[model samples]
Target: MQNGVVMEETKLEPRVGVAVFVLKGKSVLLGRRRSSIGDSTFALPGGHLEFGENFEECGARELEEETGLKMGKAEYLTVTNTVFLEEPKPAHYVTIFLRAVLADPNQVPQNLEPNKCDGWDWYDWDKLPQPLFWPLEKMVRSGFNPFPSQSHPLHSC
Candidate 1:
């Protein structure tokens, strides 16, 4: 406690999330959410972080779980804190992005949860579909490449 203020550490409440940019040479993978939640439209391949998990582990685990590809070394990227001004019921989220290359381009990503996700596809950076996730669009706009040799530090390990 400093300045007569009680500095209690909050429980955090599972506010951490991770998104991985699965790269396949010249393409990035994007999945369509069939889930009632989310935008129910466009979203990246990621989910909530598990208990006692670090950012890298969460990112790699989520990527493989959702995309069926093991992640190699992932780069540390800037974390974005999202606070919904209107929704007050624990709407805070911190998202970490990482660059991951596909282990096999020939293997297709199956819908592990068919009820939640319809399918997945590899999209060229230059040409992406409309109504993508806002953060994803921003990532593309900010020139975040998944290619390691040329990707930014935030994109590569």
Candidate 2:
């Protein structure tokens, strides 16, 4: 059964991505995904981290690409790991979070991949967008913030 038999192959390790919460004072940014990837719908400002870049750097780069905002000051927030498992587990992802402030709040969002996402907006903390992505909602519940130039690595705020 040459056609019916399954082929064996090596699997690559999971890659890491960084998501940034671009907070302008009391407001936070959220984006709407035009396309769907399984159950993931709306998502925060984030994407895969490139080689030789730090987590914070990746966050800043992704924010600019997705929202057209130049980050002022971004601080480390938190990180998470996720695995996509259906009938067969295909890929795993490690995500890092950073909280950044925008240099200009008035700037409009321009999608890096216009075919993938519709647009973005700044929403109050109390009101997260509808059809929200689970990972982002979880991050919101964590109550994390970027403390201004504290000695400690993890900010208390």
- Residue 80, candidate 2: Cα error in Å is 0.5
What's the alpha carbon RMSD for model 1?
A: 6.6
Off by over 4 Å in 1: 1-14, 35-37, 84-90, 149-157
Q: Model 2 over residues 1-157: C-alpha lDDT tens digits?
A: 3589877876859879887777765677777776434333567788889999988778878888777778776777777887765414466778887877766866777777677677777787777677776667566577744334447533312
TM-score of 2: 0.77
Question: Which candidate gets the maximum lDDT versus the true structure?
Answer: 2
The TM-scores, one per candidate, come to 0.73, 0.77
Q: Candidate 1's error at 107, in angstroms?
A: 2.8
Off by over 4 Å in 2: 1-12, 35-40, 86-89, 141-157
Clash count per candidate: 1, 0
